[model samples]
Target: MLAPAQSAADSRSSVEQLVSRMSLEEKVGQLFVMRVYGHSATAPDKADVDANLREIGVRNAAELIRRYHVGGIIYFAWAHNTGNPQRITGLSRGIQRAGLAQPTPVPLLISTDQEHGAVARVGRPATLMPGAMALGAGGSRTDACEAARIAGEELAAMGINQNYAPVADVNVNPANPVIGVRSFGADPCAVAGLVVAQVKGYQSAGIAATVKHFPGHGDTESDSHHALPTIRHTREQWDELDAPPFRAAVAAGVDSIMTAHIVVPSLDPSEDPATLSRPIVTGVLREQLGYEGVVVTDALDMAGVRQKYGDDRVPVLALKAGCDQLLNPPNLDLAWSAVLTAVRSGELTEQRLDQSVMRILRLKAKLGLLRDPLAARREVLGTVGAEAHLLTADRIAGRTTTLLLNEGGLLPISRRSHPRVLVTGADPASPSGTTGPPTAALARAFAELGFKATALPTGIAPTAANVEEAVTAAAGMDVVVVATYNIAADGPQRILVSRMAATGVPVITVAIRNPYDIAQLSGFGIAASLAAYGWTDVELRAAVRVMAGRTEPVGRLPVPVPHAEDPARMLYPIGFGAMYRRSGV
Candidate 1:
């Protein structure tokens, strides 16, 4: 899968020798991963660093590298928000330069949550491809592989060597707050197929792919960002539903597996989340599944792990639990000092610390970061978000436009009739607080297709007054398209759409984020239902063409759409899609 680790014996020897020479502080630093900002050319000047200090939480990138010696640096939307390719490249280059400047000069693993689709952290300057669910809807392993390959290429071009992506979680729970659209789908076998392809694709391009939320974050309803979620399923049930994709990932030689914040009682009887549970992380993922690669913890700062374990204690617990990388610790100095102290005392042995440090160094060596950490700025600027990559994204989006329902054949609105289409929708705010377009971009694409389309942006959670206004406004429209962003979770948006459907006009519902929205809104008399899986410009445009009869609705539902009234009942099973036919009648 990955060419037998490529000179495995030599790499191990090098890492062993390097670890032998490192001090306890340096070796401890190799286990912690921290966040740093101000990578872009447009970043505030050094004198103005204090002005933005409260926002970025650090005066400069050098502070973390020089003081803590973090093994990796994670970039969020804030750090690379400027959609400027040159600036993003400069940010990555600068971070690498800082790492290289260390005395021993171990290269930092530059990573981001570039899961493409709705979860992209550095997407503005890179090709914004459809996410895992969208690719699953397309039902083409080839397209999924290509989308990941393109993402890997763009990320690698920008000097980012790791992507916390290809979410291996099988989203079986409709109420899952976090992994809905981020996951590939509901079926374990189907998710495994796509997961393996994505792993090959990313690693083939030289960017390490981290298959996430290991025992599975799919069946749980709670969001780990705020609280700890416990999966009560037995080991047998887990093996049946949750563990297949991860097992597939290991067989594919994935570069990394990100542990979930949720606790699995089946794996570990204790209440510790997988990130801190030695039985789950080391016993199950390593001994049982045989994953020899790196094991990274999901942001330790998240409330799931943070609330249970203090900031000072998480780093040591994570290392003792067999995690190679401690990602996004809340208190860097405290965590570093705790791990150092643990090693100094008998709490954590020196050999245990060396085990993780050696793994981190070996991974760096595998990624060729040890050989050449700096990227050529000229090459990055030229290739990041290149037109070729954008075209690939567009094609994948087109294939992923799923038509879940077409009752009474309401789609393919005729241009001859010059249908007055009223497009109304809400833009769900991202977890990172980023806002997207008010109206689904489909409205603009409708006008481009020669239909008289008007977009009315509604609040995410609309009031009764908002619903009344939208329903009254749709009275005279030939067809009303109600676009929903996570309407399954937002009660007001669902009410707004139901009201529009009650207007006795042809109401076509399009799920702009989660495909499960169609199942939730199926009780309403929707003339048509489509799942774009994401609200990207490419996805929106693709949805418009499918509705306009310009392109065929080829995408199938990746996850089963459960009935709104009864969660166990399926409104539409996975692999469901209606073919569009050209007709004004």
Candidate 2:
């Protein structure tokens, strides 16, 4: 055990020494990154205690650290764990204080899903950087690095040491439900380059960068959160499509790699998900890829990893499969007890536990968390959303406006030619449940650019009443701008767009989430079409700049858009973009 008065710096060089002194329970605890509910370290009220009890069977984060001796804690905005910088920084400091006060006295890794564009856990006061697809469309490795660095600085300021970001998945499947905009792009090489840039960017800012969903999660139509999805890539196909970015990430010296929950039969024929498959996680990621860094599993609470194993068996199987960190297990108590039993029973050797604990400790030391885990509240207040960081975010968002079609030079709509403008569409919440009023935000952007713009809130699937109301509102408008969020082939938003276009008023279609929706508007007589790839204020303003002729469309289609009538035919190729002068003559 560590001496009673020993500081972390005193034993930083001797990780082996610290590990040698740890108890069996402490070693096991160091391998799991559990989730805790509420913003405070200790339970502030019965409500906070009740929420924690419901989620992890713990009373609060302090008890979670003191009792379980957890090595890490992940924050979620929806769990009341984030409000702003002060709250997050204070929570991080409190968690660290609790962790340092423990018998073993090792620092805890504070992590969050601050993936920036669509999946940011920390909201507005922080710089809302562009998403992976946006960066891919921008096609600037420098911007990718700078964006990651800026976001990383903000996260580190808030005392978040680990970030689950720069999703290295190559999004080849257009109909992919989960990873559409989160991935860099469909081209494996391009994705690899951007992944490397982001890895360098994030680590440069003193945050441990994690490249996620190893073996790839991009080609699946099914979401792993609800069910298991199998990627049917052959060994050759896997080497081509799913392996390059992970290879590049490994080469980039990434701090950690998160395993996918999907089963790839080419790698491991056993019907087991990658998180629990020894052949895939151990053989491919460790032996084949030669990755010596920490291997963390995706959330254990998800349905994909829990199909065959019970809650208790899941963590043990993941560790046995060679994962160093078991994240967000459904039943923490059960999982911890099961791992302790496995170690004592020789199903898993203490030596095996030591290997993982050593890796975790090394990562903590590399991130400087071992020396000073607590963040300064005053520094956090000034660094969360610095002016320069927000400017970089705006500049990056400006580079991602991809114009797919502008027939008859319909874009760059002059305020003198078409003075009245109406903006309406589905302002859907992101998959991570971050809500922003994108429709109103877009109108404000347009108005700020000197146009009379009105925003209408038509839900994702516009009802008959919504369509009629929008049409009535569009009667006197000079041009109608509708933002579509991942419109399906048979979605009602198509009807909404077609009806607005039929009114003899020029209509511009902006696919705010995916470029695939632009393919569905072929016969709809839309005057212009472009993809923002996201619906945040930054993206909307970028699109507005392109439409207002203030900026040219420099972003090309990062992923191919299939023909609406035939999936085999391409509507727009991967590098297709229309400049103001390049539109149809």
Candidate 3:
């Protein structure tokens, strides 16, 4: 313990020394966390690189780091689309190599939105664990910890040191379009428990954990990606529901906290979102909550901030609002210039800029990035998506396979009788509205379970004609399993499933993305209901095992499934799950 304490002191000293040497431009640069496509090799030709950079409104990766002295780089779908672990590892290493070549080298914090499940940026190459809501349904902090650890290890191996995950949002609103399955649950205390566990697990594995969308993004009905949403909770209500998990995360020593783009009139009357509100980001999160760690803003390029503040002004405003890092500014050059201008014009003090840069440097030192920024190719090959990691993912998925409703004991479909099944829902190959496992994968899982499963290719959005065709096809099947994606956004799917339920076939509605879908379509004459919470192949297989009686449905609902008609009334409350009992047992 004494040794560790001494090491921490040494790291702090090193960070302070480094900050003392950085120029004003370099210090300002450290506040910006820009985006980059994959490795330089992945860039087509010189012409393509120029064209792509122009299109995305950013400069070259190495040039940005060397010239701007950027603190970090976040990987998006374009960066890791190849789904090759080795290739991704190479890309990460290449970026670090470029950063190291700078005159005053600082290890770049290679980060990604590795939220797992549907929101994973690096898909096949990494272990695709279930999302936070599924892990919450597992009802085991041990499982959440293990899942986060495995994910962290994989990311650390790939030279990525920061994980923006363990969404602490208490998803209370059924109609919340963006944060349904990403959140742990509706209950704040339970979400707090899981958030602390995940933060510890990620940190223990050497990857910094960032509890995201602070002040809670779960209660709002709008998607910040498209528009700003407001949380109309009173101060007392916010303290009770939205603030607990974030408070718990801060207490757990979470390395970073991400600001949401939602507005809360109680915190700040200004129309500015929390990402640009000093009263919320600085006053509430830092001063009131006592969070001394780094505070990062969600993507500055998001429409929530962009539409209101314009690209040039948002970054400067965010920094002044107490955000230490600006993520994915639409135009890096413009954002950087604005920050420089603000500091020069006395709008943002140099001391404030140094304070943030110091925090960032300290975090980098803590992660040992300053010591060895590059990852070894051998370690990347040996650890990423290893068998053990995949197994851990499978275990979490299995544990969280919830049986929400089985009105007539319709589940555990009799394999002995060889039931012919019809698996129709969102197409997994090209999931209709959201990301998850494909419908084809669920059908395949049924086939693997010794059932003659026929899959319909009715895409995610089923037309009225598509529903008629599915109902006509369901007539021949003994049972119908309809997997629903985001029903809040995809209303047509719910309508199609309702029509299928009316066809007199034993309809099993499996919520493949958000569990709240069950609540939306509950009044329909569905025989059974299940919540997979995600559409990952592992999760789909686990749900199939539960249906086939091979694996028990042990998962409880993490968040309350509200009634479609009355949002206040819960159709299936949290902690609800039905266990399968064999007849003789």
Candidate 4:
């Protein structure tokens, strides 16, 4: 065991001592993760913001620290003015110092879902790397770890101790709404391996990673954000299909486990969601799986929990059921009211709260955010330089690139002969950014490769529906390059692929999402299909090089495709990404 740092030992004891002496009101502070709208505190939008912002105000940090003594604060991005780390530092420090500043103050825990890619809130919506499905397409144990490390370091610098990310939900159902892009893959073992590496990566950077959506939300076709997704799978199915990643993450020593809001009918006959299920959270997670760390609930504000349980009763049920931290509880007043009532009336034993707080506090101390806020802030913010993005972005693009369909040696269109290229899809601009990536870069890299690439502004490809026009265009073109782009909606360019296939041109279809697109567009019978997973600039250039025979198309398909028509093909046929290493496995 590593020698405990001075901060670790004292900070742990300090937190316990402080919790032990706290009165009912003081301990209540530990239960509330208050959301303060930064906009609510600022300008013209203050009226709307103030209505949502909940804070015990008096701008004085020292005074606020002593007053409510909340365990943590959620940072809502101020759209009018995106906050810089420099600006957030003072506010975060003041909130954090409250625990440390007290004579026996306990260090408060700070958490955020800084899965800061295109899907992130605080940063600009840069071209996000394809989510978990994309990662699965490009199988790299290192990629999972590195991506998480980048996320963790950035969060740690922001004075945020926890990342509610590296989503543990296995994306088994292709139609799974909210979690499709968020989950790693369909295979539990693959998801488990990626999750383990990811957790180690983030923790190595001193950021606590949360493996989430417990009891899994992968099989349902419906979304739980608006309504609870009820899965009919038996307990054995959940263990065989859904539990592996969570178990692997737990075995790998993840700091926190987040419960899903979806109802598991097979696990509980009453149909309570995992967040409020005693059998799942306490029995399975704690007793069966032996998870001893923190168990956080998915946002209580979600309709799954809120609509069914009602606002007043959720906190009581959750605390009793074994959830350690309650996320984004709607109507904080109701939550506190319920918890306080339970505590004062002897409904909840103080031992339960102590158990949760101790685990949380131990995590804070381990991350060192509890010890010296200044040093942690400086260390992270300073290291995230431009060069870091430049290098990692390349590796991410290269490794995550997947080769789904390759029919003939049609790629490597010899530049020396000036192959006539008809480029149909992909964002034409390079995904460039100071701190984030833009989606456009994926296409621009081809133009840089000396490929005579033309981008259609209408976002349609040369297909059979417009056969005469497409055939006329293809008559002189040496290669018909048809590309597919993933949108906010499902199944990219179904009609376009049909049209392209009818033209009878040797079309090269590139699947920019996961290979699951094969089920949608594979019937087109395009000679070659590539799953770049995403159109990052690095992957685009690499794809061009491999096509030209300048580089061998060594990248294998990470997920298998049983056949274009098979429903099971959606999970993935193989776990191969680009940069295929011949000798390793």
* Decoy 1 TM-score against native: 0.93
Give the C-alpha miss distance for residue 226 in model 1, angstroms: 0.6
Q: Which candidate is the best by TM-score?
A: 2
Q: How many steric clashes does model 1 contain? A: 1
Model 3 misplacement above 4 A = 1-6, 41-48, 55-59, 79-82, 375-378, 428-437, 488-490
- Which candidate has the highest lDDT of all? 2
**Candidate 2 residue spans exceeding 4 A from truth:** 1-13, 43-45, 375-378, 430-435, 582-585
Point out the worst 10-residue segment of candidate 3 by lDDT: 428-437
Q: Residues 228-292, candidate 2: write the lDDT tens digits.
A: 99999999999999899999999989999999899999999997999999998899999999999
Global Cα lDDT for candidate 2: 0.88
lDDT of 3: 0.82
TM-scores, all models, native as reference:
0.93, 0.96, 0.94, 0.82
Rank candidates by TM-score, best first: 2, 3, 1, 4
lDDT (Cα, tens digit) per residue for candidate 1, span 436-507: 563646678888889888888786777788788888789789999888877644488888888898888888
Tens digits of per-residue lDDT for model 4 on 174-232? 66667764666778898899889889988987878889889898878777789888987
